[model samples]
Target: MDAVVIGAGPNGLVAANALADAGWDVLVLEAQDTIGGAVRSAEVIAPGYVTDLFSAFYPLAAASPVIRDLHLEEHGLVWRHAPSVVGHAFPDGRAAVLHRTVEDTAAGLDADHPGDGDAWVELHRQWTAVRGPLLDALFTPFPPVRAMLSVLRTQRAAGLLDLTRLGLTPVRRLGSENFGGDGGPALLAGNAMHSDLPPDGAGSGFFGWLLCMLGQDVGFPVPEGGAGVLADSLRRRAEARGAQFRTSSPVTSVTVRGGRAVGVEIAGGGSVRARRAVVADVVAPALYGDLLPRDSLPAGLLRDLDRFEWDGGTIKVNWALDAPVPWRAPGLAGAGTVHLGVDNDGLLEAAKDIALGRVPEHPFLLFGQMTTADPSRSPAGTESAWAYTHVPSGLEWQPDALARHVDRMRTSVEEVAPGFADHLVGEHVQSPALLEEWDANLVGGAINGGTSGLHQQLVLRPTPGLGRPETPIEGLFLASASAHPGGGVHGACGWNAARAALATQRTGRRLRRALVGTAWERVLRDPRSPR
Candidate 1:
């Protein structure tokens, strides 16, 4: 094979497709019997009622240049935009609905809180100025220095400084500072909760702005049929370019020779030799400790790995409903995605409870009604609803315990959308342990790979040297969510890794030659090393 990708996740597929597009033969190996790692969609509850097993909404997907450049829309990937982008349901039967148009959303805010409309408009205007260049810097593989220079040029000095402060501040602080009214801050904080990080945690403010602005620019969309359609489209595009996918084939190890990755060993003792490079879309810790030999890893890299923390796990519940959820707040009925909580304070309390290893009685839940967003997701008049809540890291994920929590989450939703529990014709609950069993990359159910905290983002992701995807082992790279521009369904990480590999193949020299030499020396000294 010209290149062997170890996982058939979106990132892995994207990486393989890039190599194939560049005229290199590519092979993808997946542990599961299917493709699309966390992007899978299935009829888990009832017939003709498809539910997204993991990611449903695709704000990032719509904005990703990788997906747009691939033109997956040509391959049956039609997107359906919701009229009401999102809704936050408060305890007093009042809901804040974010509309597709900024002016409309601002008008709605102004109704509740005077002067909030002007604040929202100003914020939107500021974000619009830098959105394009900011996204380019994030999704491109150009060195950080060069990328920063580009950002500086595109967004003037004052704009660049504002961007820096926006990226560094916590979501809670950003919300408090920008949005003077309670409704405005609550809206910002709700979007930030999509990541496992708390609103007060550093680096979360970027997500708040990104998600909110994405919602304003392009409403969160769901692929017609299900989220799987998006993945299927990518697979078709890859196959068209001579990329091959082998499902149910788990890679045991990435075989290295002479300090260079040459092949991969599958779980059943089969091996495929890579003529040029081996790209892994597995999580960082798993790739380092399980796939590669410890002696073949640099000491500093290993130390950084030890300090890396996986984000909190999640429990997902899917329901086949007989009817749409009856919302207590009439305005929330039109929303595709609804958030259930009393207020921002209530959300903070719930987040704190999850951080302390105890499930909150009223958890901060993200509820998605696929049938409302895309009518094809369910049969006529029927609804398909799904919700997920974050849990403390490494908590015991017993099935029975999870079932009780699922019931609690359902009841919590009922508080906002009355009669929600009664509409369920069928239900499926997936605990954190179940998620890990489905995809090992979701280690401990940290779906976004690792924590999205300030200390672990950008060049510091996975670890400093490994952020750009190049590893100590020549021709091996990290193309998973663990890399820079972390998480989301965007293929930036995979694209960057593929570009780097192509560059190295042309140069005939690895990027981290010194690190490779050190690892090779340690491997040679280990008497117990396998020949």
Candidate 2:
């Protein structure tokens, strides 16, 4: 193969498609029987009820230029926006809804806390000024030096200073500084919880701003059929461009020669050569430990891998409900997604507990009513709801323990949304271990690959080096969510990796040939013996 992509996850598929589009003969290898990894839709509970295996909502899908330019809708993919972007409910029966329209959302905020309407409007206005440049900096290949320069040039001196300050502050501090009301802080904290980070963590403010602004700019929407349909469409487009997919082929190793990746060794002793490049969409730790030979990796890289912290694990529960969740607050019944807890303080407490390796008594639960978002997800008059909560990583995943936790989550939701547990017709719970088994990228149910903390984001992602998707080894790249731009179904990581690979291929092909003899001699004469 001209370019071989290991793991047919969304990022892998996107990378393969990009390579194929650039006229490379691409091959995608997947360990599972199905092609899509986390982006899968199946009738897990009932015959007709379809549930998204992992990711359901796609706020990034609407905002991703790579996905947008692909015209996935033309390829049988449709997007359906929810009536309200999201809802955050409190224990005391108070709820706040973020609407698709900024004005409406501001009004909702004002209703909740008297003067928060103007505060929200001001926040949105500030976000609008920097949103384009910020997104461009994030989504595009890094060392985003050019994008940063452009942003600096465009914004006035004071605006630039404000942006800098916003980037540095934690979500809790940012909310406190920007808006005085409880509603503003609650909304900001809710948005920040989308990442594994706590609201008080450094740089979490950026995530809060980014997600809330995205919700306002483009409501969190799901694919018409399910999240899998989006992947299917990408597969179709890639296949049309001459990309080949091999299912159930798990890669065991990436074959190296002269310190360069030459091919991959499959689990069953089969090998496939990559004539040009090997793009791995797998998580970083897995790739280094399982796929590559230790001798091939630098000592510094291996040491850094030891320090890598996978994000907290998740316990996911999907339910086939007889009816929509009856919220104590009536307006929340129509929400597509809901964040349930007491308030911002309660949410922070939950996050703190999870970080300390204990499941919170009142876990910050994120619930999605798939049927409300897209009616096609369930049978008529029925609803499909899924809820997930972050748990400490590396915890033993026992079925009985999982069931108990599920019950606790049920009770938590019921406290906010009355009669929630009674409506469950069928339930499916996936423990962290189960999630890791399903998709290796979600190592121990760390959905975002690595923690979205300040040290692990943007340029420092996957490791501190060139953030432009290139690896130290020639013709190899990290294109997974572990790379720059982080997680979500957006193909930015893959797209950025493909573009980098193309650039490297253009320049390195000739340069590599010239240095082949010297490189081989150096490889053979190395003092380090192969284990």
Compare the candidates by lDDT and give the number of the best one.
2
Which digits, one per residue and each the tens of the lDDT, describe model 2 over residues 1-531? 898999888999899889999999999999998988889989998877889989998888788888898888777998897788888898889888888889998898888777888888988998888777777887898768787887987799999988888877889998888676777787788888889889889878878888888989988999987888988999999999999999999999999988788999998889999988999998899888888888887666676778888889999998998887889988787789898865888888998998899978888888998989999999888888899999899999677888888888998899998887788899998899888899988988999989888788766788765555766567788889999888888899889988878877877766754553234334333344332
Residue 178 CA displacement from its true place in model 2, Å: 2.5
What local lDDT score does residue 277 receive in model 1, on the 0 to 100 scale? 95
lDDT of 1 at 266: 91
Measured against the true structure, the TM-scores of the candidates, in listed sequence, are 0.95, 0.95
lDDT of every model, 2 decimals: 0.84, 0.85
Cα error, residue 446 of model 1, in Å, equals 0.6
| Cα lDDT of model 1 by residue, 1-531, tens digit | 999998888899889889999999999999999998988899888889999998899988888888789888877889997668899988878888888899988998888888888888988987788777777777876356665666677787787788888887878898788766677777788899999878887777888888888899878999999988888988998899999999999999988888789999998889999989999998999999899987776676777789888888899899999987899888777788888854888778887887888888878889998888999999889889999988888888677788789888888888888888788899998888888888888887788889888778876787755357888778998999998878899888888889888988776674346553444444333345433
Work out how many backbone clashes candidate 1 has. Answer: 0
TM-score of 1: 0.95
